[model samples]
Target: MKSELDDQLCRKYPTLYRDRHGDPKSTAMCWGFDCGNGWFPVIDVLSELLSKHNAEVYASQVKKQFGSLHFYYSGRDKYTDGLVSSAQSLSSMLCEICGSQALIQTKYTGWFTTRCKEHTKDYSDKEYVELDVSKVAYLGFGKAWSALVLILIDSCDWRTEHNGMPATHLSITKEAGKLIVSHSGGDDFTYTIRSLHARFQ
Candidate 1:
């Protein structure tokens, strides 16, 4: 009778196995014949594997949920004037043209001036127009200058409108203090630093 019952049970669950030496032991090992402690019922083993997979899925969902919550609660507002003001403060301390210690003075509208005497000798009398260094077709400026130039060109509409204007180019001529923009039109408009600000405003 017991042998018939065991055969029927094994047939019902192909993956299930039993040790029938004297005492009966049930197991769900992948290898149907191996009746070791490691063997578990098929459904129980599959449930554990599925549980581990589900844990990973749940973890990822939680991470995305937290990320979205952070964006809604804090990230958006933290980037307001506080961040801009901090960046501007840092910009004032560093030179935007060259990566040197900028001469912080009342001139240049309290912004950090990048034109050293060597660079500004030619345009000493003329106002030094601050052009976006990124658009100027030159490299070798440090990271800060590159970032500043990128921001000015991207954010400032005036700079964007005049970026690729024909006959417009920045030059460091012998007579210029810093780099000045020479626009070749009817009057050969030479934009000095101060004049550039006026035009933008």
Candidate 2:
């Protein structure tokens, strides 16, 4: 779901708004919901181009992938192509998270994100102990989550047994976006943990 500020931006660029099924207002869902408000300018330009050509434009998809916006449109013409090019150029200067003016693109912990100074600082500095699962931890947490946990462990250079045995003295920490496995050590790896279950499922 998009924030209220983003919903206002969506209303301003209705042409860029579409449900996951590519239907018009069929749902309150948004494909670019994860995208920051920076895309607003790009969509605004696209909307203007659509109006100029009197073309009916529909976004088949709109989302950020691989650190860039993947704005799939059904209509293609000189104007639309130009709009895409302009958007590409503009995206480099806009934060991928909040749409603020960005000064840098970072991959500090393996996940690439373009962000302004504020978001960049937040993302770069954000760190915490995500989990401390026991060997008997429930799998109801699901395979996807297990995969992520394993990845994070690998990133932090933490040793793990295939049996999912919880380390008696395992320590998980985050520093400079990379998960660190020890209370003190140089060993570390870069992996992003997208979601953490609040309770054992």
Candidate 3:
């Protein structure tokens, strides 16, 4: 997820992310959200419930795996288990890019991701508002996450007010905005992506 959104969750549920400020060797959170921003709502809801139930539970990890959400935790309870399970199931049907309904769940480029059909295409003839985010992909983790960010951005257009149910489609309205997402530590980015020449670290 984007650092801006990630920050909100952490700040809202400090205890749920108690390990976030700990040594990197001790917590995966120091790497920030190790997944895309599409599932922020899922995490947010889960965090809220967990925090409400027990302010001492720690989320060991919240990431994607096998094209679905995987919310690891320290506290064990039927409610927590049920919540995590539901989020995972919901993730399979929601686009990992925009939180809209997904068409399919499959492995892309050897990585598991759920995407809407529009996010998996290449459109060069279109033009829209562009935010040149040559920086921002890297959320200060390192080379590994930088590469992950590149993959996620290929289909991450956050606008949810467009035409399609997913709000983005292979044949979009000529007036619709554009998007480009990239990675580099200490910052985040989104653009009406022209194209990204990924140079992974």
Clash totals in order: 11, 2, 15
Q: Can you write out model 1's per-residue Cα lDDT over 23-99, one digit (the tens) per residue?
A: 32321222222211111222122223223323221101000111011001111222222222223332333333342
Which ten-residue region of model 3 has the weakest summed lDDT? 192-201
The sequence of per-residue lDDT tens digits that candidate 3 reaches over residues 43-97 is: 7776776688677789877888888888888987755665566556556655678
Ranking by TM-score: 3, 2, 1
Superpose all Cα atoms of candidate 3 onto the true structure and report the RMSD in Å to 1 decimal: 15.9
Better of 2 and 3 by lDDT: 3
Ranking by lDDT: 3, 2, 1
lDDT (C-alpha) at residue 61 in model 1: 8
Q: What are the RMSDs of all candidates, in order?
A: 30.1, 18.0, 15.9
On residues 1-201, what C-alpha lDDT tens digit does candidate 2 reach at each position? 256755664566565454443445654234445566666555555555554554466666556655665667666764465455445444545576666555345466767655666666656544422223443144334333443344344423433343333343335444564433433332111211111111111
lDDT of each: 0.29, 0.47, 0.56
